[model samples]
Target: MKQFLILISFLFVYYSTAGIEQAPPNFKVRDKQAVFVDFRRAQYNITFDVQNHRALVETKILFEQKQKGYPLFDLVNRPLSVTIHDKEVEVSLIKTPGDASKLRMIEKELPKGIHQVIIHSEIENGTRFSTNDRKPDWGNVSSGFFIRDLRDRMFLEKYLPTNYEYDQYRMEIDVKVTGTKRWHSLFTNGEKTKVSENHYRVRYPDFYTASSLYFHLVPINRFVRYYLTYPSIDGRDIPVTIYSNYRFYNYLAKKKAWKVMRELEADYGAYPHDQLIIYGTGLRGGMEHAGATETSIVSLGHELFHFYFAKGVHPANGNSGWLDEALASWRDKGYQTVDLPFYDSANLAAHNLYTRKTDKRSYEYGRSFMGYLDKQLKEIGKPGLKDFLRVFFAKRKLTTVTTEDFKSDLEEYAQMSFQADFFQYIYGGHMPPESGHKHVDHDHGGEENPHHPARTEAEMLSIL
Candidate 1:
């Protein structure tokens, strides 16, 4: 009997500690289970089995405001009563409903440093409503209501743990609904354990995080099936998906689309998430989510490039999200085509063309610049390029940057004014600078176009 007990105990220990090697790591503690959030009563009510930090808030918001089904994410004229750790605090609230939805509460006095906050506000139930297309016109484009409300967590600054910077935070979400379906598909971080027709729960480490907006996949549309792309750059079983309206594209040429992203991995490192995605959306552009990025299928390379640049590379040039879009577009070329000078000098010509189309969308320009930088990095030596990117992001902490910042940093590093013309070209959208132009090889430009055409995924294994 004693021997049997010992054997059982050993088995438990082995299994508990055994599976971690193949799984993603967890950095922060997350709350347990699929708990319900009930806001269908008088004032927004919140209750959770407190295992960690806790906050209780009472908000004075107009319950009769026009709700396009995304109220907490929509505009509000109501005041708030913030209660953190049982202490009532006053906070000023502001909301801007746009692509970059802004909701911030300015409070001058606090203990001054970091403090976990909780917010309780009356928000629209976000239930499905048949609109012009089940998507409201929030801006020039229209989208399913919840898509616009992605950053809604930041709407309540008085009692919620939200800010511009990324960090880990625990949340217990409870939204009351009157629908027949009690289960909703929740796409979150971590492994999928619980799955139902209505409820979906997943967990994640989330070292760096921003407020996210997501409902079940069905809220927008129905699922086709989870498809797979290359499992990894080395072709490991890195499964990526394309949630489409119809069947997943299976053309031999279509699978070739992932090659661009594979090259991107060589520089920034393999995809942070194995599941690179491009979901069908009504909007023309895409948004860079942490794991599964969403955009149109035809724009797959450009969209995936955003994940590599925005999520992988640190922001160097400050022009809102410009660094993200331009870098992605630039990276797409190498991934899409094996053409010459197109990988090198020809890329610069495209970049000059990109900048000429004033108001050509910010993200695309950022993609181009990122591509330019990658080619330049290869020319300057990998280690030097690594150092260049390091210096660029390190100097600009918590702020957007511009090529001017790089020019200044480079001038200091090279001990001369480097790429001054390039800086102006980036800012003024002028012709590519002679020195910074991707085609410029004034002195030592004779490196022989060094990209191989028949390099299979097997050969690419060396990069990872």
Candidate 2:
């Protein structure tokens, strides 16, 4: 524990008591055990700094915990070779040599009380980027590594530090990385911040790491001022930040994303987040991490909505991911629903809809399902669907959520009560009866479904 505390201090040089601003409550839940981690990594031109089989490296670590003395690290899986001043220290905890970002040092024991931890790694010959890939045309949304040239590498960390959900980890990663001049700027959350000539600390205290895992029960959420957000049609103050090693592609697309975000919010719910960012990657399809949404050059808006539906509502568990995707896809021409359905991400494949399928798990399926729900909802009133969302979440506030919880929520809504017949839809596997409105026993107070598509979604505030 003593060694762990010492390492944390050196890594976080700027560690102080001054608190950074936090997000408002709306899209997020506050828990006492939750805390944020601020990380920074700097890269420099080591050719001029290395001499006599040694490299002169300097690092700055900063950690600020609301409560202090948290169990920092036990050096279980971290890769490193450590030395303090001129003397070599005994190995036991946190040893980061070259790739500090990949270091997954878990603590064997928790600290006695709340405390902060920081550590710096001054490697021997300096770290190299050739181990990772870096390709220029690989697209900004790509999640894996890409190779630009012999000396340049575009590293995308899609499969590292495996966690149930990044939000559960509750740490912010700040990287101040510099590579070849041709590879210029670096991007993660928003705009790129330069630290030095070839060295920079490009880390944000907001990114939730544990949520990046591709699985269910993945805890991911956000906090924001719902009233201040812009609708999708009008877009919001969302920014498009591109962080790359080369200035040629290193740029900020702020206005562009603001346009798209408002347009999305106009149709969906209010855009949440102190800021919306389009993280550049090297993948064909982008993943929607809470707060930050990754977008490729082609499909941007559809994926961004996942922040609201997928991460905001569904946990990317199973079919629920499709619930958001299909609903977003049902709409046409941006925010214009055109009296159809709307979901996020992309549509489900043939295999996803039928074979090997369980519940609502595809864009095609979700649109079909939501379209059916829309008809059923018309009678029970818009509040029925809203109630369904609230009820489903209420059951599993801090635990897991299943498809049955969703089905049960809707069934009890006085609309689609899950009777013995509804069991067919749940287990025996039956798609929603086409045009659920034929049996409507109630009337909704709004414009006819076709003429005013927003009547249901926008009925509450029209301008939300």
Top model number, lDDT? 1
Candidate 2 residues lying further than 4 Å off, grouped into runs, are 1-157, 176-183, 190-193, 197-236, 242-260, 279-286, 291-298, 314-320, 332-361, 381-464
Q: Give the residue spans of candidate 1 off by over 4 A.
A: 1-81, 94-103, 106-108, 122-161, 165-179, 189-197, 211-221, 227-229, 234-236, 248-257, 266-268, 314-320, 332-423, 426-464
lDDT of 2 by residue, 1-464 (tens): 75576456535544421212211011111211222333322121212121122222232223333332212222222323333232433333322221111123323222333332333333221122222236432211111111110010111222122221212222333332222232223323433355553333333333332232221100012111111233443355444333322333223334455555665555444554445545443343454655564444444555566565554553322223334555455542222222333322222221121011112234343554455555566655665343454454444323223344456666766555654333332222333222121111111111212211221212211111
Candidate 1 least-lDDT 10 residues: 32-41
Each candidate structure's TM-score, on Cα atoms with residue i matched to residue i, is 0.51, 0.44
Angstrom error at residue 154, model 2? 17
Candidate 1 lDDT, 79-109, residue by residue in tens? 3445444466555443321112233342323
TM-score of 1: 0.51
